[model samples]
Target: MFKEWARSVRYASKFHRKQEIVTFMRQIDDLEIYANLSKFLCDNYRQALKILKSEPELKRWMSVEGIDDYDTFHVWLEEEREYLMGMEDGLPKKREETVEMEYVKRLKNLESSQGRLSSILKAERAALSDRADFNPAPISQVACRHAVEHRNRDAELVQDLEVRLGITQQWTSESPEWILAEKSIMDHRYLDALDEIERIIVERLFEMTKIHQSGTRYKMRRHIAKALQARSKAIRNAIDRYNTVAEEMDPPKPTLSWEEVVNYGFLAEFDILRDTGDSIRSRPWTRRSYRVAMDRYFKILRAKEEIQRLNIEIKRVVTWIEDEDWFLRRKEAEYKDLNPPLAVQISRYRQRRARSDYNHMQRFWALAKTPGFTGSVVPGVSVERQQARHAERASRPQTSREMEMEVVDERERWNSSQEGEWEDDDDEGEEAEQEKVSTLMYQMSVLAVDQDDGRTHQLD
Candidate 1:
């Protein structure tokens, strides 16, 4: 409080560095930075310790009652320089405009990222709530509060990132896709868990920015990519929602279905059966056998496609898990309501279903082959219809045996031609002449009557 003390604290009131001078100052654990203050405090340590020990609240505030009380006191005394300095209203205002400005710079950096994200999340939630028989529970107020609190938190986080990444200007979303990678990472859904947020936040933010209609000059081909991202996102969300249900509720067992699985496996159209199988094989998600997994995946997502299929998969998942003694009690009361249980009668059921499916599939193929069934991959089309269309081309006229024969014949002809040309072309004329001369000389000898040099040249 004295001029000497003020002078000790400030000496010159100079800052250590530009950006985080205060934080750095606050972080200084040594008495060296405040050597002047240390001397001033040391001169009065005895009296200060004596007076401070008397106050119970002060002792509790710093837990001054213990053996380390002096240590706490000294540390607090030094670090509290800022706190103590604040008490003096006129104590040379040490506002770090640069720090605050740096924070503002951070917010600007994340502006586009935050803008596009929640709009999508909210839109999706709203849509899901609107469907017939769909009951949308208002996001739990806790979730709502989280949503609210998250705004500020995200803002702060983005700001912090800008500072850390040394980003000065806001990223212009060059293409919707450029932002998509970042934006997708921000999504709580895409993340393994909320705890993984920090690492993925920037990633999602980028993904979000990628799909935005507004792209910056710095970006390229990003629009097309983002357009694809949007298309894939539309399908992925539906699949993800379908997969979250418990196994017993669906015909197929619910399991981990990542974006890579759905995008490459389900939506990728096969030139033959949409050829998604090959793509599925190549994906990072392809480690496990996906045939059964695919059924489960289809089951969960089928609700969005065919409500009937949706119901079937849901019941399958629910029942599989619910019926622990599935082996012992193959048939049960629960199986009665829907299409009859496949039970241990799976083969028999399959035979019947196969007959029904064959008829349906046959009809589908007939229709598709008839040329009127347009190639429409509409968002609103029934999943069964989609499957029907694909199944029509399932065998895909596999290059026909007739065609294979033609290929073989063509190959044989080519080989025959190649075989005739295999000789040493450079010496052909020389060999022909040698043989011709041998014949001609024999004839010539007959004509010449033994005296011509040609007869003698024929050797023995």
Candidate 2:
């Protein structure tokens, strides 16, 4: 009877200990989930703050929705993150009976606190979601959610809609309308004129290329080219309008010289010279004509600079697209194998955005390539004089090595003259004259040494 009682007590103790361990593990899993949720909420809060700070209009909208004081909200989020991190760090590692009990109690308290915080976060997220203009989630997250919710819909159409929606969101987020509103009427008109020019150039290019490649189509091609030249008059008119507006807004000050405005007369050698002939010096130049010439000259310089900038931007965008394409392609192949619907949708959306950006850049390149759209002729001047002046400036000795060589040559000349003087000096005053010469030479050597030291420091 005693043996059976002891066996029963042992069995009961084992079962109870197993039950305790199982409960402890369940608490651990729950705490881990709570920690993850806390991290997620913190990230969302951070993203929200970033969005609000960037968009003042959105902040106003949110204020209307009763979520004012982002600074306080940001502080609260930071505090919550730190509190959760502390909780995680303070969790017990040892599995002693006393430590386990203490850990369980702590976890229970943490659970209650986390539950309350989670509820608050959920309510805050709901408030943000209620505002149509404010979405804290990234483009990918939004697209993924949409894809998951509407998996039964047409995949391609859904993807396209997501891309369009993303673009609309981006456009609104940038608030270009506000930016345009800040510009003057003249600026708006100038932009419209530029758009018209771009449209004309694109149409002309399309018309010229629409014909088949054959000998029979030669006349058609010629007709198209001639017709496009007719549009050149329209282009010229638009450019005149643009120039008038630009000159008004940026008017050339009297202090600016022709060389300063026209990149040292390099631009004068172009089509401008053809239109004005060699009459720049011969004509009775008035202030009005000077201002007009300065405007056209500056426009040419601006166009050249813009073209170079656009080329660099295009190259950078192309490189970015290539890298993005490689990454998305790999992601897409993985998605195909795994058949993860949301991942596939997100990848497609990214690819669409990249393609759209590339097309936009290419259009910009086309617009930049169109000539005679920026401005008309620079005042004609003597190209030979300009060339000679530019050449003289270029040929001037400006390098450190050249300066050093000049200094060495001067020192050699001085030394040779001193030697000749010494050879001619009489013995009576020779000692005194030699001392003076030595003193002068020492000073020159000291200066040379100082200059050499300065040059060495500059190199270093």
Candidate 3:
């Protein structure tokens, strides 16, 4: 109190005690600054009274901290008066005419800065505590409830945005992992806009993997499997497309040197066994390993029906040829035992056809599946992959909507705060509007009440 008394005495001394009074009206300069100062004072009056020494910890208490126009003389006056009331006429309202002129100046400033200040304007409503003949605007009880509803809704929206922002942070942290995983299968570069899509894809993959490992392995089993399969197919097809394009890219157009092939910008010209060792196809064990791998690959292929038919024909031919050799020798001496000569001739022709087919089949597969010629077509392989490729080629990348942007646009439209929008439209009563908990809740309640009230009023 003594310190405050001493400070006041000094402040009083700084001003001239003149008889003229000068009417000393410089325009308030910034009405926003005044409005802001009043709010800061009312908000932080108690904090200044209990000022602490630690600068960092006392930031909120000090005028330098948080958001408020600390430089404004009006704000400084307010901080003092807030904790110490009846402390003179308290930050005198600028002389009426000058205050009006300053307000006009600030009003004009709003035109260019409206978009920037939209959030600030809506947010400033919470700081209104001055009801002393300055009844800012007529806010009715019904309107107050609506304002509260709006505030609550806005709070929820802010909280949701905050949560999403946190999620975005977590997503950003894991983005490199997503980039790596996507690159593994996609062979594509990164896009900032695609962060959401990439995160979702990685998260989906993780979830699918999780589901596969979890006991939900049984509940909705088919649905989960289908989702996983769909994603896997998309990735595989994307890879296949990449490989196809890569193959058509001139096959690297290698400028092979006498000593080595140059790959990856480096001259790996010092391979010890480049020309000395047998190729994988010529080596016996290497040949066997390839055949084993090829068998597994073909079996896994779904549309191998045509290849299976060819295999059946080969098997039938081989079986017929084996028995016919013995049958023909036995029949040569036992012609009298034959039911019909025509039937016997037919049987002989079948045996000859079988022998010819077996040799023909061997030659076809010799080049195709042979170990040394592994670059050729896979023998007896199904056409499923070719069909799938055709199907994939028919589709293309599709566009999706930005739902967050859409939601924001909706909120902005509703939040426009038109001059008289809060006026009650209800013919029933303002009392009814005052009681709603949420707008969404209110809407539902209205419909429910209308239905119930209709029935009750008819009976009454």
Alpha-carbon RMSD, each predicted model: 45.1, 41.8, 49.4
Q: Give the per-residue lDDT of model 3 (tens digit) for 229-261.
A: 676555444434433543433322112221121
Model 2 regions lying over 4 Å from their true place: 1-286, 335-339, 354-358, 361-460
Which regions of candidate 1 are displaced past 4 Å?
Answer: 1-152, 172-460
Clashing pairs in 2: none
Q: For candidate 1, lDDT tens digit of each residue in 1-460?
A: 2344344445343553333445545444222332233233222333333433344444353343242343433343344344334433422222233433444444544564456557646866887777756544666534555555656776778667567757677454574533553343333232222112211222333445555546544354476466556755644554455345323231333343443343332211211112112222343222233233333333334323443332243333322321222222223223433433433243243333323322332232232222112211101223443364356447565334224324434543443343323245533344344334433532442244224223333541
Model 2 scores a TM of: 0.18
Q: Candidate 2 — what's its lDDT? A: 0.43
